[model samples]
Target: MACGPEGDFARSCVPSITTSGHRVTLLTDDGVRIEAAHTPRIPGPEGPYAPSRAPFPAPSADLAVVLAHGFSGSLERPALRRTAAALSQHADVITFSFRGHGGSGGRSTVGDREIHDLTAAVRWARSLGHRTIATVGFSMGGSVVLRQAALHGRRAAVAGPGEHGERTDAWPDAVVAVSAPARWYYRGTAPMRRLHWVVTRPTGRLVSRLGLRTRIHPEEWAAIPLSPTEAVPLIAPTPLLLVHGDRDPYFPVDHPRMLWAAADPATAELWLEPGFGHAENAAGPELLDRIGRWIARRARRTD
Candidate 1:
């Protein structure tokens, strides 16, 4: 019992829990193939708790939320499945495997090239005719969402073409980044140090491939991409929510604080949870429900 692919499969085998969804294939701008899954929202219970006011509401036809999982995670991960299930209460949810995770093609460049993965997912969401869209990311994925939002912001909208050719209205209406690091090359924490070893050493890469089912690219960044703190400033106008747990082992509260300080107060909100741990695993139903409500409100306003 560890929570690897097999563990996820075993859990899904239980008669009570069903983790089925529509599977998809996506092509990144660089021509990498990404595996994805889409789950329509589950309607809330009727009666006393109205759908509109319920913690989990009926799905909105106009809104869809793209979920970005942490490193070593895929759409099949139980934690990610739980996250997607919770968000599906309000809007349709699309979860995808990043470049080198699960069945996706190409090797992971950690967080650098993962932006394209997210971009492709968002574009797919748009193509489905969703009038509003949001992105919620955890851990390494948290940084990707921030960078993606900034890179596609109105100010930098024309910086480059999207997965296809069009670049207009390709960004998200709201963003939620949980347990994201503020800067690059952070090895202050033990977990991050172990993660660096996994990404930096050949033996570590082999271990990741065999043990964690993740394939890591064995090259250094050609140039440093924008950090989360650096990207936060450009997300203005669009709503941003930063959620970090005080008890997280990979990153301390200072990381979220840095992102908050760099963001525009008019549109950015930060939540520092007390007992929460890290990423999708630590995000419980209550927290996820709250996030869903926030996205519903923010996306409605943006629309």
Candidate 2:
């Protein structure tokens, strides 16, 4: 269902979440969750998303951080943990494996279906009353974050500096994309030609074929799906921080460089990490501090 002028989405339209927290929850008429998690890590040693959470960042901050994992990746990646730790200072953090990835249910839809899951997740966070939300995604997850920000993240309507589409109604205050692939998969890009089979194609087919919730759902890019370069226009004027490694194996280093070039410049920002390659396990302390402070402008600087 489309978001109404009132922004109240119907509950029947919302997707279900496999692992939320200690308790199982109900849905609303808007198809969104009114409350996601009361605590960061759920009770007991059996917590699935808990152990992956940061100890000091306390997942109860005012702002809600939604961290997304990349292809075949889980919520346990070191980068997500590090990012979550840094984010803990200002908001309650929410990190989940996408539908088909980790302990979550459903199949990966590449960008097509994943966007819905992300939308639902964002709506769930909004219901928590955090008032502000931000996202950080790795690799493909970076694409997810950018889409959500362009479609619904905070800075969707920055207006004049760049060429953001007017259709944007939802958004995060700020967006961080770590090693984002500006060129999408499936339709045809250097990454797809090189990385799709191991990274995308097979996974997409598996998601659709298995009907199981662990695969990434396939996205038909040639259709209406937004390409990475196209999304930059929507993020215009909204703060965009992109991190790409110079030595990334999957895609060329020029990918981010081209992305930065294609971007309108007056608003978006890009950071190409020289030594870090691809979706890294750890971001240096300097990068960590930069991310932490960057998230602070919109979230809360509680930490």
Model 1 Cα shift for residue 250 (angstroms): 0.2
Q: Which portions of model 1 miss their true places by more than 4 Å? A: 1-21, 46-61, 158-168
Task: Give the alpha carbon lDDT tens digit for every residue of 266-288 in model 2.
Answer: 76678877787666354666776
In model 2, where do residues sit more than 4 Å from their true spots?
A: 1-61, 76-79, 153-169, 186-194, 199-224, 280-285, 298-303
How would you encode candidate 1's per-residue C-alpha lDDT over 59-83 as one tens digit per residue? 3347899999999999888999889
RMSD of 1: 7.9
For all candidates, the clash counts are 0, 21
Candidate 1 lDDT score at position 7: 22
Quote model 1's TM-score: 0.86
Q: Report every candidate's CA lDDT.
A: 0.83, 0.58
Clashing pairs in 1: none
What is the TM-score of each predicted model, taking all chains together? Answer: 0.86, 0.68
Per-candidate alpha-carbon RMSD to the true structure: 7.9, 7.5
